[model samples]
Target: MTTPLATSSSVFLQGLALSLGLIVAIGAQNAFVLRQGLRREHVGSVVLFCAMADALLISAGVLGMAQALGERPSLARFLALAGAAFLLLYGWQALWRARHSNQLEASAGGNGISRRSALAQAAAFTLLNPHVYLDTVLLVGSIGAQQAAALRGWFVAGASAASLCWFVALGFGARWLAPWFARPRAWQVLDGLIGVTMLVLSALLLRHALTGL
Candidate 1:
């Protein structure tokens, strides 16, 4: 029916809009993606992996899959503990890199992580974090479930499309702006920022761990 089609389309549009709005805000994920893109390293796999992960999450949400996922108390506890630990570990590493890697920018040239390492790390960072599941699986899924049944699919589709488009654009687009990040000081600044972001996120996760998310 025309009514259903219209509803579905609108839902998709809404999903797409929300997804773009949320994802575009600066974060570690975006930073890494941009860095990889600028260096022209494993751009295809990284972009696709991020998008596909989003697609899976979006699909799960639309299909009301979280209902089952959310019911597992032991799994929830496990993820929470694991995520918290990871945040702390990554935060320390980021800070260490910020302090130690400042001088290496000249010799290292833009190769932050190797091609294979970049791919693996990007995938790990994107997928291994339970926070991602919470965002895409729980948060997005919950929202999708609240929508009208026919519109749900479209909404998830729209959100998934947003992830796909944004990551691709961001990854490839970064190379054009590589000139600005040429200097060692620039790398220093970048690492400092990354360190700060990691620390902040780690603190937030630690807080959630203690106070209940």
Candidate 2:
């Protein structure tokens, strides 16, 4: 039975808490957002794009897109494998850029990083992540599906709001670390961290693929 409005409020709150808890964890997505934030170049667009992307992905999850994907493991594996390859490629590019473009931080280019480029990077990074489907689509969708039809919206709303909040916070909040990253040594640390993150995500996807086989 669908919960009353009052109960629905509490349920949604719980869902929001859980969703935020999961989304707040440091990942490649978070790293990219943080990097853009600290650089202070096009932060707003990056934040908005990421939040919107999350909303779309989460909506699809709740709307049964994942079920169709799950029905095709072979296809899923293909995406997973391709995603893993892309991650490895991106990891390399991120490292090269971090090393070379570390100088571009303070200098404000007239046309900084461009909206299309930022959105492309975010979408590529987000969609190519194999775990995103498992986490947002499968896990979140299942939770939403379990709730009564009326209450289900509450759960999804909580989750979607969480994603927006997380990306915005991550994108804007990283500015605090700007001074620290100004140091060349700090770039090494940041670059290394991003590199390690990409590698970890890649390994996880490969492991998942192998296990599924």
Candidate 3:
């Protein structure tokens, strides 16, 4: 028979592994976080906001919000379309930055963006993406709910821990790349890559939204 400690450890590890699998992907949110990290502007606030938002969503999912959301197809579609539109705009902005690559530079000091603006962008990136909902709410939540009642809390804790660790690493670890991004050409390439990724994600999301209609 499995001891309580063993069962708890198993559940927590499952949550950590699953969450990491879902989150450690190249998406608009990751791109934005990476950019902010490279820019060294309000990285703490951005990371904190993203991690906290994820934790809230994960907790909600475990608490049966997943079932509520699953019953609402219209809401999912709306979110997809909205996310696509937002991604398209952000993609355009990234592409514009790439085109004007001369202005791209790794700042050793502060970048001119305010904390409020940074937080706003972080919120938009976190909240606007339907994938975030699908992953945290539907996928993670459903799986978590399947666990023994006593262990659901442990699962959420593990998942929340993963988010916090990931955001902290990504937001702070990016400074190591500051040397490479010191060159304008590197920034140009990075922005161009981000632009293409955002646009492709937008297209896919838009297609998903329309197909469901």
Candidate number with greatest lDDT:
3
Q: Candidate 3: where are CA atoms >4 Å away? A: 1-3, 65-111, 177-213
- Residue by residue across 1-213, what tens digits does model 1's lDDT show? 444676678678757755664465345677778777866778888898889988997788557643543566455444555544654565566556556534211122453566688778787878787767866776566546545556677878898999999889878876654454444465556555555654554464456456644
lDDT, each prediction: 0.65, 0.66, 0.75
* lDDT value, residue 76 of candidate 3: 57
Which is better, 1 or 3, measured by TM-score? Answer: 3
Candidate 2: deviation at residue 213, Å? 31
Comparing 1 and 3 on lDDT, the stronger one: 3
Candidates sorted by TM-score, descending order? 3, 1, 2
Q: What would the per-residue lDDT of candidate 2 be over residues 1-213, giving only the tens digit for each residue?
A: 646889689657745754564464436777777777867867888888877877776777766844555467676666666656765775676566556535213322344578788878888778899878876776566545544567767878888888888777767877665455456666555565555556665676667666778
Pull out the clashing pairs in model 2.
Answer: none
Clashes (backbone N, CA, C under 3 Å), per candidate, total 0, 0, 0
Q: Is candidate 1 or candidate 2 better by lDDT?
A: 2
Question: For model 1, what is the error of residue 145's alpha carbon versus the real structure, in angstroms, after optimal superposition?
Answer: 0.9
